[model samples]
Target: MAILPRSQRLALAAQASARPVSVPAPITGWNARDALDEMPATDAVLLDNWYPDYSGCAVRNGFVLYSTGVDSSPVRTLAEYNAGATRRFLAAAGGKFYDISIAGAAGAPLASGFASDAWQTVPFLSRLYFCNGIDTVQVFNGSSFASASFTGASSLAFIGCIQYQNRLFFWLPNATGFYYAPLNSISGALAFFDLAAFAPHGGNLTAAVTFSHDGGNGVVDFVAFILSSGDCLIYSGNDPSNVNAWSLVGIYRISPPVSPRAVCQYGAEAFITTYDDHIPLQQQLVALKLGQLPPRSKVSTAVQNAVRANLTGFGWQALYYPRGRRLIFNIPNADGTFSQHVQNTALQTQPWCRFTNMNAYCWGLFRDNLYFGAAGGVVYQADSGNLDNIGPVAADARQAWNTFTDPMRKRITAVRPMIQAVSGETVSFGLGFDYGDINIALSPTTAGAGSPWDISPWDTSPWSPDAIVDPRWRVGGGTGQSIGVRMTASANAPTVWLRTDFRFEQGAAL
Candidate 1:
């Protein structure tokens, strides 16, 4: 076989490591990674359009904005033809116009005057559910329409809302009253959270009510709300327990067009986005310091062993990890202060995945990846690993070293030495070196192969060349003081150091 040179070999190895590992897209596993490659840019959907339906409108930005019309006409039965009506707005967003049904199937055209907003897919149910007007709730079973009618909602007027806990929750404008219609049981279960007393004249609550993890803190749990005034309110989720009195830790009031809807945490920073603001101008997504938690340490070594983990804050409302992705966080604008340079690259990807160019939006997270609702009811997902913890590894020449062969002379690639441990004892150890390995001799005298020593089963004498040996094994208990030997290398290989700990179990008595 023709062998590649060391230089060429190393370069090939590095390049191979750089390419992202691809996984199949949800459902089809169709490797849609390149689906949007040749997609016509003219067909792409913009951020300004409204999508009303369950899994209603998907956007490339990793969010699906479903609208639940506040009110609906009871008498109109949408025939098959009208059920899938295609409408072209005065402003064209270039994508092919397709009927928005429950799932490209049978459903009455949306009840007249019914508007949809931020309706998310329900787990285990194929239907997309949302609140329409004040008194009515609607559902699309991927094929047909089902509705939950309300008696008092016909006249209840509200502005700006979100879906939570399998119910449509919204705040009435000017009245500041919170109402919810359960999609599962809408008739009698239709209830409204009496927020009228809390914010009379209706303190504009922009989005949905959400909770946070207290991590066992008993005093108070936090709930979040966005005011129509564009201010954020963080209050206690206390129900008169008095353990924690509802108080505002931070008040955020951004300018108009800067309507804040979602707030999430990333490490110690909180990122928030507005309803319709795009990239920079809308200040759509902003990062803020988490008042409850401390900043995460950069040093990986220190981070693993530190006593204080520094995790804090309440949970999120609108955005959540449905599938694939592990950790998702949002940052508020820095100190409620705006910066012109910072852009919310929240869901930017090269070779964007285009599904009919309608709209791409993220619904949930599973297995550390994001579950997205792309155009055509086709779903797409991306692993969160690629987005988080991205940076070049800092290189250092002086940190390199070797061991075993010649600490001061020979440069070693890798090395391992023998180790002998006694049973019933706990062993604590550490490795300190520059780069190369240091060999350590476990037992000085040992019976050669084929004798009782060989039959002992516990003996690893014959397999001495393997990882069984520690290059630098320092004896313990006597003059050695229970400390293992030191393995020093002339060069370091960005290695495994920084005070490691592990339990070593001995097989048999020496």
Candidate 2:
């Protein structure tokens, strides 16, 4: 009886198709199945003309702006705005404050009281509240504008604003605190009646927002404060009037070097990009859910080094699209453009993807539509159509499998890749042997046209299911002690890799 060589078992565990700073060992099952340069998904088309130096973005009262002028622009502008009574899309631009809701008419300058380029707007009680920490908060009740008597700290500027629980909250950065005004207050006072004291951090207030989570018993609302020193304080309970009613549910820390404005709530968690203490010198994209404590796991490790190398600075912006369950982070890239790190939470297993071309500076979701303002004054509707910025869609994924080691030399007989290609799409495969020293391409497969219901041919075959495909490709002859595989797809067509199988036979050891 002859002794036989031992067979080995190995597989690539499911992981985000991330581009790591350095590739892991061939045995580490977490290597990305896609390349770093290839976008995680298809590219989106540009929806409007360029609006140079696009700055802030917001969606309210059923209007979306393709671009808003930066602070320095002569008319800190918006393409359109709606006053309550008008059905016309008003073009508002010019002066410190402008109203643009009149049809076919140039926007008129708003009240001159507002400070130049320092406004943050929020919608509540059928009115749009515009606040600049340097001036009194302004309100537009659809048809007209008025100023509210803000009875906060004297000269306390309102840097940010949000609406929660039928109340309007404003971030008083100058005071290093926040104050709220009840929407139904009888006195019509916009006063800092309730102060959100952050005594623990000693006041480095940067940004604040509200989020809600399912806290076992029921849904609970929490206010999150982001400080310049990287500490995040989350408080529970709706009313800030009663100090005891608010409880500190969690105190988490993010990278100290982060833009104060770079936080957004998605589902029950908030996502931010900042330096990771564990991996010094690298910025990590992290997620913090309610009740999840510090030492948060880094979700962007696969691309941490890439992110650190490409970031122009700490300026970042983030937003969540609930309809798509996607969390998008926009960071200025080294080349002046922006890199959008998109995370699809619904796909838990493979959640991260990168997008470019839009170079979005900010994002807003209005009326269930996603809009982003990019450089050169361009605005885009994400995932709107096939083309990207009116150009060809460039999409690809590079997958590397774990090394298949054998006690003796092995001759690879067959390689079978299970892939699902969208109809009218084609996907290509590539193979690498001996730690990818040698690479070869396999036969490309073009998916067949799926069954059509419009055709009148009664004698028709059953619809071709996506799962049924002949992925087996013969690799005539090759002997290797260890083998690996790399697969790629480059086209507008979408493809998904289900799995891959290999067959080999024992041979003489090298």
Candidate 3:
């Protein structure tokens, strides 16, 4: 008689596949097929959207001011007024900007000569700059609200504005160029300088952001511009006026059909969401760090199919919160809700999570807090409480690990799941043998107090080891060449799939 191995260990690693159609065979090392409706990190809770229907958001003086969406009958806007004795919140609606400082406070037209109610506001240089992409830029200083005047040009309209290197840069949609005001100057009398002539490539300038870092010579200033044609241009220099001094450092190409507002800078890296032209409607979330080739990894593939099915044109938004080390993309769904794909860059273990039930239109990071505005003049802070949406919503985290197969045919007797979970948390397991020919449900396992944090006596708490739960069923005398397991958790508890141990009887080759 020859002795045979009694058990085998199968590790769950890299659960990147989320689409059921793309689920890989368990024999491969690919860990999961889906992790939606849950957080990206291992054993973390899924948080819901905080507020209701706010369409726009901006952070000022430690408060998140939200504005109503344009879909409503009368558009509403929110702006902070801190000029002189007027320290209040202003509301703009019904084709007019009003001073809604106090409840019942008589509404008055915005003194800034804002002719239209549609405006996107951003705070920079001690003032709030407002633009509707068509009208002249409006600024609300601490003292007064007024329209900005540019030298040589009677009226200046820009799609977006960003403050970098003490200078105000605006994206010129009409001329496919970029114009900037003097360094640290926000006065209406300053002349706007054009950088289009100096730019290397010719294309519609969709977005621009500055990146500063200490280099060989000293602090090097670089501005990255994204073109409508999916080309990225980088210019290096400290001064924008000295056109000759600013040299083109690098250029990279990305998939076109991307949103102009979906680009964000994280450290020295820029993350953008775009669709692959080669693949029909295949969306990808890519990252490009300064001085490096574009990364080939599509971090958003976990929900790529779902996003492509629901995303509308190039209207999505991307935001990065440094404190949480999170990169969030808000993609509009056809159902009027929004699908927020959150990536935890902080934890390299598990980096993707898809969140739903929230319809955030805009996001703002204020004082290390993440704030978002939804559709109906509502705003909420993220990571504030455990509850998701508005009520106690249960988490729906699920994963299907790779299949386990023996070199020769075998009879699977039982499976022992080694899971680390919070006390009282239950994890359900589904077993499929012989490439899913025979499917069976294993007895659910409830984890014990597996960590010191789960028990009392905080300082003196002992670390409890993990408990391996063995299924009682013998697979109904199931015989197969391979086996796979799928696990799911709906409770708001932390869970981590360490590995699964399989006990089987060896048999002759088929």
Using lDDT as the measure, the top candidate is 3
For each candidate, what is the lDDT? Answer: 0.28, 0.47, 0.50
| Native-to-model Cα distance after best TM-score fit, residue 402 in candidate 2, in Å | 1.4
Candidate 1 residue lDDT tens string, 1-510:
999999999866644443121111111111111222222211111111111111111111222222222122111111111123331110001111123223223233333344433332232133344432343345544444456345555344344444443445555544444555555443444455544344423365555444433337543334455555554444543322233733544444432222222344442233343332211211221233322322221111221221123212111122434331212222222222111111212332211111122222223333333433333234333322211113211111111111222113211121222222111111222232332232333323111111222223335332222212122423322111011223221111111111211122111121
User: TM-score of predicted model 3?
Assistant: 0.65
**lDDT rank, highest first?**
3, 2, 1
Q: Tens digit of lDDT per residue, candidate 3, span 395-474? A: 33323323232356655555555554446666665666554532325667666533433333222322234322222332
What candidate 2 gets wrong by more than 4 Å, as runs, is 1-121, 130-140, 143-149, 173-175, 182-203, 213-217, 238-241, 244-257, 277-298, 302-315, 348-350, 404-426, 433-488, 493-510
Q: What is the lDDT for 501 in model 2?
A: 59
Candidates 1 and 3 compared by lDDT, better number = 3
What residue runs in model 3 are displaced by over 4 Å at the alpha carbon? 1-122, 142-146, 149-154, 189-202, 213-215, 276-293, 300-315, 348-350, 390-427, 433-484, 492-510
Candidate 1 regions with alpha-carbon error over 4 angstroms? 1-128, 132-136, 140-144, 154-168, 172-175, 180-185, 189-203, 213-221, 233-271, 274-510
